[model samples]
Target: VMGLIFAKLWSLFCNQEHKVIIVGLDNAGKTTILYQFLMNEVVHTSPTIGSNVEEIVVKNTHFLMWDIGGQESLRSSWNTYYSNTEFIILVVDSIDRERLAITKEELYRMLAHEDLRKAAVLIFANKQDMKGCMTAAEISKYLTLSSIKDHPWHIQSCCALTGEGLCQGLEWMTSRIGVR
Candidate 1:
């Protein structure tokens, strides 16, 4: 009985531990989304030069999330954080149609990395509240999300400022965690 109690306590204490990384182009609202998840409110933020990290708990699951800087020069350093990440949240600027290709390039590059082979991807089609933004389906097509056969992935339309659609995205994440 004592051993069973200890095992249950340990699982409860650790929960579904995961190392999650959020990455995208600069101005894609990665920080805002992180703040929304952390505080459920918008937090004023500037361009992240390196990364912003926080512990987020959802559905009793605990995970360390790293919101990496998305500037062009900072993109090369993203791999340094990939060691044990189990989930990848790729935020897309739904309104920046011009940069969708670049986003695709980065997504493909990250997915191609050996360290990320098993990481499940969560693509946030952010800025849904903006006018003239692309739809999630369109963005998915442009990003060729369908071609990714090795890793599990999902795309969610969201407005980080209002925290809309974020719950659904997180639900998918937690469910994925449960499966693992």
Candidate 2:
């Protein structure tokens, strides 16, 4: 019995890997967050027309994350990447107040989709360092996170450019991975 527990832990810590998809509206900083996890440094980025894939290890769990493009034209392709995804990282521009409604709409749409039904959600209220930016609580309210009952969800305030609050968010992800 003790051997079985050891084997389980070994498999989980050494071999287990999760699929995560980073998505959001165009210019919401998804790529920046992805790079922050990988290199721990901000990368100069332009609008993503396709997707970026990378492996990231946090708290001993391996996560193969895909940072997908968020332009209106590319949003339709998001579903193709949802099949094996265990986590959906939604990066929102905290200062982009005018687009909050659109972001909320996209979030609910993904949550309702059959492919993503089982995935946990992490909403990053990014750009927190800027003045007049929405707080994490405010973004949660705007996105109606309380209305979501089917999946585990969390909202974290972060400054992707500066790589702040990013670790705490990932720590939450790694913690969730062990619960089930």
Candidate 3:
């Protein structure tokens, strides 16, 4: 159809495509955030066993987002997709104070991979709606983000359940990608 042809042409002309991966420990709300971005509504999600991928368009830019399972057992598979990724969205359960150290360890290990050296990282300090949740600054400090000299990094507070701050995070990411 003519409409389909125009759509493809528009994509070819003005669409900027980027690959991004979402990662975090199990129960960190990665899937919830993805659904929020896609549907603009809260979605109930189960633990991801492997991965779920979706394409999103924001500000006329196209993004291929991969939501990978974050269980300890699936961590090893993360590196497999790092090579082509332009950005990494690391989710954290801001109220899980007890697991901050574990999250830090896993995050550092992921950053150390050679393929991720140039990828921009956006850490989502999720669950800000909960009581006693850590602020973005606190999470950044605990994650030792200052030491991440290899890539451009940022931390944003978000509550996936309520869809607060999700668009701002994506806007930051698109800016980092050099797309207007």
Candidate 4:
């Protein structure tokens, strides 16, 4: 009975909630990463039309994550959901070197939005399992992350298929947001 009471009291005070959005070019594995977090397994995904909102608990903190569609036509609508975002996950297909310029452009545009100026940014360099994929450091340089000063940012190399580096990224995000 005493232990149960302590558990109840701990739950009352230990949970924190945060809002995060995952944005990137199409086929960057945002949905796969989301599934990995939610289901602990990979789920085959088609291109998202608008967005997928889901809640996940990491380190005892509840995170409401919005996985937004990254198609060129849908990119313009991303800002509409940024108003209350606390963290931004920008996934990049490390093997898609040809489209890095487009990714860079879209990323900078999102960062320029007033609502996200104070949000923590986590760049997931996805597809690291693919041959000749860029490393997280290279992606950061390609994206010119050094130029971003308004938000705390991190670049994590991740392979959604095998679930490598994903938790570290979330842990980094939670740390940046002061959750842990």
Q: What TM-score would candidate 2 get against the native?
A: 0.93
TM-score of 4: 0.91
What are the lDDT figures for the candidates, one per model? 0.94, 0.93, 0.90, 0.91
Q: Model 4: per-residue lDDT, tens digit, 131-176?
A: 9999999999989999988778899999999999999998897777
Task: Name the weakest run of 10 consecutive residues (lDDT summed) in model 1.
Answer: 9-18
Could you report the Cα RMSD, in angstroms, for every candidate shown? 1.6, 2.0, 3.5, 3.0
Could you give me the TM-score of model 1 versus the true structure?
A: 0.95
Candidate number that wins on TM-score, 1 or 2: 1
* lDDT of candidate 1 over 89-119, digit per residue (tens): 9999999999999999999999999999999
For model 4, state the Cα shift of residue 31 in Å. 0.3
Of the pair 2 and 3, which is ahead by TM-score?
Answer: 2
lDDT per residue as tens, model 3, 98-126: 98998998888888888887789999999
Residue ranges of candidate 2 with Cα displaced over 4 Å? 1-9
lDDT winner, 1 or 2:
1
Q: Which ten residues in a row have the lowest lDDT in candidate 3?
A: 171-180
* lDDT for 21 (candidate 3): 96
